[model samples]
Target chain A: MKNTFNILATIILVLSLSATVCAEGWDVPASVKKKQNPYELTKRNISSGKKIFQTTCKSCHGDPGKGNMLPLQPPPTDLGSQNFLVQTDGEIFHKIRTGKGAMPTFEKTLSDESKWMVIAYLRSLDKMKREAVVTKAVVNPEVTDVKIDIDVDSEHKKLIAELTGLKKDGKRVGLEGIELSFLVKRAFGQLDISGEEAYTNEKGQLIVQFPTDLPGDREGQANLLVKITDEDNYGPIEEKRVVSIAVPTNPKNILSERAMWGTRANAPIWIIATYVLGVIGIWGVIFLILFQLFQLSKMRVKSK
Target chain B: MTQKTSDKSRRNFLKSFGVTVGAAGVVSSFSLLGAAKAAAKEPEEMVNLLTADGQLVQVDKNQLRPTVTEPLNELQKRGREGIAGKSFVMVIDLSKCRNARKCMDACQNHHQLRADQHHINVLQMQDSEHTAPYFMPKPCQHCDNPPCTKVCPVDATFKRQDGIVLIDNERCIGCRFCIAACPYSARIFQWTEPKDSEKYKDLTYNIEANVPQKKGTVSKCLFSADRLREDKLPSCVSSCPNGVYYFGDRNEDAVTNGTTGVTVRFSKLIEENAGYTLMKELGTKPRVYYLPPKDRAFKFNGDLLNEENLH
Candidate 1:
């Protein structure tokens, strides 16, 4: 009986442990877990991975792989957590390729290289202390003289930001291969331009065309902010510029206001007058006939 | 004695004729006075009148005329004159919709609509078998030249200057003329008394809000005219998880997506997206425009195919 009791206790313990593992943990094969990631964590790969994550994963996994828990039944795993970070790249790759439960299979959607790049991007997030990366440049303090000039072309609806790198001698030179981000400040928050990150051209300028009808304030004024985000060479520099767009005017359709076909407000004066006159004229004639009939009845009584 | 009796009868007849003529003249003169009063400009003084129930009521001298109330009151008037200097417009991007019925739910809650009554409906549309299915949310087109308003004998349904079409439930006679005339089939008639709480039931009806909805009246989307007056986005626009609907003043040429808070050029969005109004051939000149379902975010899952399951 003592041996049986020990056996039963062990069996129950094993069952509960397995159930817990099945519920939360993935069942990755041994061979798949041992497989290695073939891609390197290069700057280009990390950026590409960021783009993919934003477009594909941000909706469910959130901005920094924190996992949006509201919509999912069994919430998505937090990719930034240590429990997730401890997993090998092969396990993650296999789980992504062959999805389980609520997670979708991304094998057909992402190429192997893209998958590896995304894994690298996820790995990089483990080092981030906060949700957003705020890089303060301590490298070259002399690059503080960079000036950003913004011009708006109303006809084409384009906003051009020109970045001029100024030397200590006060000479203007164009900076190349620097990433610039342009955003429009709105009432609620900032609206970033689609394809917001742009590298400076040969002229050291980044031009972005806005939608023609992008609304500004009540006065038709839009505020644009341009930032230079090159942490390695220069500190973060931001410039703000204001531009005015055409304000929409009221529609000029007078026919809508008229009361021709039973519009109550602006009914024609003549129609109301005619209707009233006709009612009075018809009623007067009927009253006159009724009086004549009464007069005739009196005359007949007199004759009798 | 016979001559005396005949004389008395003649006197009675004369008196009766005089009374009849006097009454007729008084009635006609009152009508004439009403017409004259309508033609005259506003008077500074107020007027007192006796109603049919023997109650004396004091009213504005201008309202003494039989013409429709010059300045519409809260209950008796149609809200045909929209908020001035505004022309509202909406744009729906079909590519972003994933049959999330949050817009409908929001509208129903805000409007206090019945289960069968939907001011905005999401329809499963497939142009052809080769094309992928997509969800199309249909609200009242709020046409500039609304056919529904034209057929309304009572002028209950009318277009406002701000590009909203509203129904005056107090004025609607339940003729269903507007319903028949509407090509979009946007209007819904309340067949039975609406199940409303006592609070809404006791409240006076406002056309802009269409709240405390009455039975045997036609109701459709008013584009949240009351909310517009408050300078807020419509319930559906703000409630959408996906940025499907955009609302703005066409006069402003800018439409903001309530979900993303991204304001875009209304004309440019329509032009670039090859946006088309529903049944453009009808020439309804709808205020609503739809962007095509190109490059959709998700595959058209057949979840909404059986709409009964959605309820």
Candidate 2:
């Protein structure tokens, strides 16, 4: 029985070992593969997608085409390679939406637009498309001069920002598809209140609801920061506004009290008190004994 | 003559008794061997299992065993470097803690700690005789004025610029000075070979997470320095089923709650919730904050209450 059991165990172990060596293919659904991306592969989409990729996909995938992907059982595909780029946009989209093996599903975390933007960014890494992207950049220089207009809607409790960019010809056009972030300035870092949705609409306007429950300084004042997230393309565009839209807070400082365990400057008074009182009490007793001895010596001299 | 006669009789009696006993033993051994053979012949129970290809098959239950852990991933080996210009802080809500011990479990798993050893402990707390009892999940406060760091004779334990306290086991002589210096009793020492010594023997020591733990070295809550590098929450912080933990950069002045994923102003959260540090009188200037158990999420069931939990 033991011999038979050993034989059976060995066979099963060998079978399991071999199963891991064989490559498994990703199953892309027919309906998903046929679906087309609605968004255009513009520079704006590519740039925004690049930013998303840096934050979300950079760690595992590494730099595209650099072959610096993390070492895993089934290695992450270098999106720059022809093997990955040959797949249909819909096929890539479905793969990203419904992840397999080590890759995580981004359907819930990212919107459809964000996924398309990532694809657009990934497609730009192609050798043929690279030259075209550069030529297009030179032909139409990016608008550097941009202005932000802040509007506070008190009745609606909304903070609004409008962005406009000036062309070389001096004509101002509302900048669309730009990502804007909202944060409340604190002592150390800015607290992001933009939540999930932060992109400006076609009119270059972004509106965020002012949280009523947010605790502010004594007079209920808070510094609100509205800034463009895509600084690489748009440059630095930030506007700071002081708004009274939070619950008033009077903070208490707990470091005021002196403690025994505190530093030399902030040491407890009890130790010093104990040392002084102890010295006086001990010396007083010694002096009293000496005085009695002196009186006894004086009595002896008088008797003599 | 009488003594010799008795001695001869005694030897003869012993020889006769031994012969009978040896025969009886041999008879019993044959029966015992037969019984063992019978037990082995009895059919082994088979467990039904589905293959990766979706085919169901029957296999002996003895074949089932947990697979060996995979090698360290890239993110785990990503060094103990602190994030520049960032100081991390944690705020624990006493009201939310229900003695679930999920945080403890996560911390232990991340650091490769034994079941008895804990990087974070959920302690039962009560102030006075009539006061309400609450659960307090205590981790290393990572004090700015840390006594533990000051007492490290070999400089094995040190504080980082990013407000994280880490231990280098490679440099540790295991004198246990930091363990004695810590007033909060946060540090623990490995008395014997660490849990899974053989499995993790090849793994390089991660200074930030303090894993593959070595024997005779002291380890405590690292505040998940490794996870912080990836802008992720600590194991204890993220694993809590209740919204008990809030972790963030002190430099950002914002802390995101583990369960709710709600980021709030550090000062405002403390002021509004009346958050206070543990052992304020000690002047350790702890980075960890605690919200008072004013309005609790769950009633004090005392499920984890025992002799050790008492004051």
Candidate 3:
């Protein structure tokens, strides 16, 4: 329990520190104002959309997709309704043909497996329907309740993380994807890891399996370090965490435990060195530039 | 110094104008300084997106294209996700729904939804392995307390004054944070550039009515707030066959399933009976309410589930 707390507390400290450093008030600096979407008003998008609407749905939904269901009394709900805008993509497509309640469906009415055109018409109507309107950054720290677990199929291995507890502050700068490095130590050299690569989800969980083609793994035998590299305020970044992976073997299929990694394969020293050098290189360049600029301004004032 | 920089880059134009910004690129330092004076402005090749956590990285103009479309409402304004007064919400009655794909198809057809990227999806859900299964079709809940809005760093997915949630793909950086934050898993990310129409082919991004969903962005149902503005049912509500979904203004105290109008106090309807919200523990305060399986139509059909449909 104490060890677990130590690990958990360390994780918390790292996270809070990250959050404090990247607070939005810290200001990410301003971004270039992007131009409006290119589709603001063009032919192919709007006209093609109209074409699809005209060809397929006009009969039921009505021209310009403003159709009614039963005869007159209850005007078919407007296709151009704001009420329709808030649904999930799956729900909308499912309802079109099967018919929800009063309305007759068009599963048979229109059949363009690719529904991109329909989505287009939906937007076009909104563009034409609503009143003319107008419109309107940051990165900070990453706090994590992060850990990794490995699951093994008789032939493969899975890596998982308790990343859900990881939190990114509201004002945080965005994170690049996670970078994980799998390694085993020198005392045992290298343990065979049938499949060595693992992938992390947005929540920070990871799972990986060695291809059956590669040798299956053995039980309880490797030291692993998962390195995660993400973007930092200063420059690009990379980080690391260590864990143990013990590949369990299958008695039924003895050879299923084909050898994968050589135990000595703990991440090479070069990777850490490279990471440190890269970070230093990036920070050094920025500092050097700032220093020179400071000196140049001083010289200008002196001359004056 | 700034002027010299522009003159060096814009030496070609200096002949015509006494002091000028050269136009090799649109956003050079000198040109930026003399921006007001120059009409022949170059298009800035890049823009920066500030992540929710406060990271600023420059993104090229080419990177922010079609996926960035206008929103149907003001859901993407700064500091506006879960912005009170912009309280969009929805209620899905599970007892009313069946395996009927009507709502899904209608949504697809109406939205001109692209394949592989469902604006809404039907979930064959069971809270636990022992629990009975039900057809749970998902649309953007337009939550009153939307987790999607809460986690959105740029306020790309936001609530509107009239209780609607919408996306402004233009302002969206496509980080998919909203997708992760949504417990209902109501949101979907565009893995590839949407096979959008030509109209969006030339327009630059603006925040209103997100369109031409770009690659690497999050999108979900917007509850057809535009339809509601015109006093019409949402495409899904109007399209469902079994009257499975009911939509209405809680303030007006009326709800309808496209064909039938069932008027009752919104609060009373939820309280008088066993209406429930999915994943209630998550505190999303979804707009959609479920009537439970007390008296459902059609036997619970587990056989209709194709494993492929589980996702």
Best by lDDT: 2
Per-candidate TM-scores read: 0.58, 0.45, 0.38
Native interface contacts retained, candidate 3? 0.00
Worst 10 residues of 2 chain B by lDDT: B71-80
Q: Which candidate model has the greater lDDT, 1 or 3?
A: 1
Rank by lDDT, highest first: 2, 1, 3
Residue A298, model 2: lDDT of 100
Q: Show model 3 residue runs off by greater than 4 Å.
A: A1-304, B1-89, B199-209, B305-311
lDDT (C-alpha) at residue B250 in model 1: 77
lDDT tens digits by residue: candidate 2, B1-311: 22233335544577679899999999889988686567556557788989999999997654556566543322222332355556789999997777778999999999999889988998888899899988999999999788987667655676665778788775577999889999899999999999998998887567788888999899999998878877789999999877789988665568888876767878789999999999999889999999999766555766575532232
Model 2: lDDT to the true structure: 0.77
Per-residue lDDT, model 2, residue B247, is 88
Identify the CAPRI category of the predicted complex in candidate 2. incorrect
Q: Tens-digit lDDT track for model 2 on A157-184?
A: 7888998788888877777766788888
Query: How do all the candidates rank in terms of TM-score, highest first?
Result: 1, 2, 3
User: How would you encode candidate 3's per-residue C-alpha lDDT over B1-311 as one tens digit per residue?
Assistant: 21233234433354556434444444466756475435325445678889789999887654454454443233323212222222223456676566677777777655546755576787777879898888777777666666666556654565554556666675578888878887777788777656665656664442333455566777677676546545567788777766567665553333555634443334556777678877778776677777775555445757566542222
| Tens-digit lDDT track of model 1 for B1-311 | 22233335544577789899999899879988787677567566778889999999988776565545333253333355577767888899998777778889888888879767899999888889897778899999989768898778766777777778888886688999989999999999988877675658756567787877888999899888878877888889999877889988876566789887877767779999999999989878899999999876556665685552243
Q: What would the per-residue lDDT of candidate 3 be over residues A200-278, giving only the tens digit for each residue?
A: 4454455555322221124434344444422232233222333333433332311122211101112245654686899
Lowest summed lDDT window (length 10), candidate 2 chain A: A132-141
Ranked by DockQ, top first: 1, 2, 3
Pick by DockQ: 1 or 2, better one: 1
